[model samples]
Target: MALAVCVLFDARTERRIRELWARLESRGVHTLATHTHGRHHPHLSYAVLREWDLEAVHQAVDRLPDGGPFTLTCQGTLAFPRGRAALAPSLTAELARRQESVVAAVRATGADLHRNYAEGAWVPHVSLATRAPGALLPVVVAAVADVLPMPLVVNRAALVDSGTGETVVLPRIP
Candidate 1:
């Protein structure tokens, strides 16, 4: 199980993502919509912890200054190794700095950060398919292209349990 500091999408963006998930599912592709625990919310994670003291991680993140709402324009599709597919968001300096800050704060709590989430190494993405095979890249790409240049409004931040989808909603977008 992992815990992540995530920035959640606004209602319209969330609904659009969910609709995309349904479309992907109808095409025989697996998505977060029906992944593991089946309660995933549409989000982009700042830092994912492989190991952490829940309360400590939460407190560490909660202490960060509120970054407030921002927008991420997903302009392309990303097919990572191991059949993972996602939407590649056009990053801004503000997004990068916010992610770095969150990573640093979580690390300060002695949390074991997922290597992929390490500051400069991080690629901001909104996951679409969890196990799409290479043969299916075109399908994933086509579906994502339909939503290209999609602007995702990030209006909330929370500490989410990856396994169970349990969330500890933070007061501000941090």
Candidate 2:
């Protein structure tokens, strides 16, 4: 199972994202809302690990600063090379630094990090659809355009088991 470090949204933002997911699902677009585990939540991942020492990862991450809370502005739609479509966010300096810090802390644990999530390579996004067909791109974009520049507050972070939907580490970002 893959493990991920993610920044979770506040309740209002989470609700909005879930609502967007419902709209996309109605348009025949597959999304994390219907993920197999049935426990998917809207999140922006800082890193994903292919392999790891669980205890070591926990210890390392626990030592990093909470970085407090910050707001992310979703500006527009972004398409990944693998046919995934997401809401792209403005990567502010604070957000970039926080993410880079998380990457560093997680990497120090000897975990194999996903290259896409490495410090300089990470793309900040909240996924809207997976395997979205080329023809459906415009539809998806139109569905979410009115909500462009959505502001989401990152108030908490966690280490989750992607396969099982279990939170292994929940750091209180006070």
Candidate 3:
């Protein structure tokens, strides 16, 4: 149905993101132990496609020219497309370069990618939460506020399915 491409953080790095999320959870500000098939995880989303062929998406990302090796600093929070809660980061050239490449490469698959993200919606974030419980957004934001300006490194990106458990690692072009 739909597919999303994201940057998978290293185990150690992801742990920190999880730790921050856990802190938010403790404050009763974010969802934990998700019931949905898609369990929550920390990630920087690159793009989403309307019509996705997982294999093609992988190939597209795989072929993307690498220009990463950047750090994104989270400055605030944002809600989008739906109830998705996200941490907004100050844009970095490398992040934008890699993101743009993924969008363009995926479009070559002939899928109509969301223009909002392709043109201007790329926020360059390390997800704080997604599909948030309407009640917890404010708390989550406040919890994260104490830790605002968390910086995440972007070294590699991947092609993944949001619903099904699937991921394809694309080598960084650096």
Candidate 4:
């Protein structure tokens, strides 16, 4: 099972993203919307652990900074070669620094990290659809294009189990 350190958005932002997901789902486009035990939340993952000891990870990250409801500007849609499309957020220096800290803290626990999340390799995004059909790309793009440069408030952080969609640890982000 994979564990992810994710920054969750506020209710308003969550609703906006869910609305987009609904639009995609209506078109039969597969997305995280129905994945992860059907409990997926709109979030920007900072790091993903391939292996981890739950308690150890919690202790390691508990001491890290959990500041404001930072604003993330979603520039536009970005697609992966594997048929996944996501909202690309402009990475601010502060977001990068926080992500680095999370990676460091998780690594300190001796957990195996996903290479894609390694310091310089991470790409911050809020996934919109996966396994999307080529025929549906234009539809998906058109649905979200008007929402470009969307602003979202990330006010919480959590350690989520990718397998069960359970929140393993939710540290209070001040």
Instruction: Give the candidate number with the greatest TM-score.
Output: 1
- In model 3, which regions exceed 4 Å deviation? 30-35, 131-135
Model 1: per-residue Cα lDDT over 114-172, one tens digit each = 99999678999999999999998899999999888899999999999998899988998
Q: Which stretches of candidate 2 lie over 4 Å from their true place?
A: none
Write down the worst ten-residue block by lDDT for model 4.
165-174
Clash list (residue pairs), candidate 2: none
Q: Which prediction has more favorable lDDT, 1 or 2?
A: 1
Tens digit of lDDT per residue, candidate 4, span 8-97?
989999999999999899988888888658888888898999999999988888888667578989888878767789999998898889
- Tell me the number of clashing residue pairs for each predicted model: 0, 0, 1, 0
lDDT, residue 114, candidate 1: 98
Query: Local error of candidate 3 at 117, Å?
Result: 1.8
TM-score per prediction, in order, is 0.98, 0.95, 0.82, 0.94
Q: What are the lDDT scores of the predictions, listed in order? A: 0.93, 0.85, 0.69, 0.86
Ranking by lDDT: 1, 4, 2, 3
lDDT of 4 at 95: 87
Q: Over all chains combined, what TM-score does candidate 1 have?
A: 0.98
Residue 88 of model 2: what lDDT?
Answer: 91
